[model samples]
Target: MPDPAGQPPPSSHTLWRAFVPRWAYMPLSGEGAARFGGRWNPVGQPTIYAARELSTAWAEYNQGFVQHPALIAQLRLDAARLVDLTDPAELDARRIDPSIHACEWRDAMDRGKVPETHRLRKRLMGEGADGVIYPSFMSPGGTCVALWRWNAPGALRLTVVDPDHRLPKTQASWV
Candidate 1:
């Protein structure tokens, strides 16, 4: 909510991500979404989707269905050039509707069509957005962020809360 007037996200904030155990070690990597695609990114685009709240991250990970093993991590998100979909003014300036958040991406992909959300994300990225913050679909009133790039010129910084180095050092643990 720091930039309702079309600026970056807060100077800093906390976000959460619940990752599958197989990919837990690489919590910051967007490879999963890159390979599988997501509501905000096309199959070849990388994205790290996280929640503004812990419970919302859990809900987003399970997607209102069966619960499974997960490695939830707290992330400290730093200054970001983001697009706030939660703000009507921002969306209006982009000529995007709020309904883009609830677009049925899977169904559109099933029909071999591009979902509007993906298109919107693509357009935003082209316009230099590091990510997008929007209302969560599974958790009402909660917010979520879908980050597309990091370590780039004018990109955001996202780090995991593993101060003790307890997590795996390499992805081989999952391999």
Candidate 2:
């Protein structure tokens, strides 16, 4: 997929295999943390099973953010016609406000489209590490995915998706 202006597209392996990195930075504002009940913490270190769930959740979230508008519109337009089929009571109960849903979807899409930038070298080093041993860093636009999963009855899983594949893997590895 092509990267949006001011946003980097995820690497193939990252898209298919690992957690996105931007998630690591979130609960960006205190509001986000409050939305999730409080300060967020990972349940455990990254693992293969957690990674798989992360990928699935991220895929679902991204698809929803991207397609919610169209899907909501189509569902609303068809709701009247579908009302008579099979369970009428069930259909009525399941009905959603098209306009409201559309608005929400649009808002989500807008938020998703916003770009995130990071100063890698500066972040890795200290704020005043100019001319230090660290290499020069370049700022780039990037997109990220956040996935939350239920690892067990009471355990939660969190993963971040880095579109640019900027995270370090095993020693001596490169993305």
Candidate 3:
């Protein structure tokens, strides 16, 4: 993806992943963590594709989404973390179906195409370091997907944080 505001693209070697407790099913201890991921519940929750750079994650999460307090704290402290899923087999196992596409929200809204989906499958299929790292279709400063992989417990290391701790207000940046 082209750098939107003259900013450099993310480093080719590293990608970040963000988690929200409610959406991500991270178990305390078990193999099930390997299956941790979000679902595409259009009626319940709209499809969201995002990742990378703590600041970008911050902007995405703090965009007036009105998350639960506990979840907010959890995200602020630990849900967002760096990840490395360089193995092709590991990444393939968690790849989203090639047929499932994501919409470009802005374009759709501007053109009055409310529920239209763009060629997301095509974009995600494009090459990137380790996997696919692309700019977010929703947020300018955010990445939509990094590494193009998920649900690999052995590859992810979630940081544990105090659920009650609150992040400084300075971190909340709205789009």
- Kindly list the per-residue Cα lDDT of model 2 for residues 1-175, writing each as its tens digit: 1123311222222222222343333211222322322101112312121111333434433443552211100000100111111233322443422222113323343455311111221221132211111101111122222222223343332233445745444424422
Worst 10-residue lDDT window for candidate 1 reads: 1-10
Best by lDDT: 1
Q: What are the candidates' C-alpha RMSDs?
A: 2.5, 20.9, 12.4
CA lDDT of each prediction against the hidden true structure = 0.84, 0.23, 0.35
**Models sorted by TM-score, best on top:** 1, 3, 2
Q: Which is the winner by TM-score between candidate 1 and candidate 3?
A: 1
Over 16-60, each residue of candidate 1 has an lDDT whose tens digit, in order, gives 999898876788888899998888888988789999999999999
lDDT of 2: 0.23
Off by over 4 Å in 3: 1-15, 27-50, 65-103, 106-117, 123-131, 136-175
TM-score of 3: 0.32
Model 3 lDDT tens row, 1-175: 2234322234322233344544333312222222432221112222223355555555555554665332322211122222223233423444534223343445554554443223332233233221244444346745544323322453332333445533333323321
TM-score of each: 0.89, 0.18, 0.32
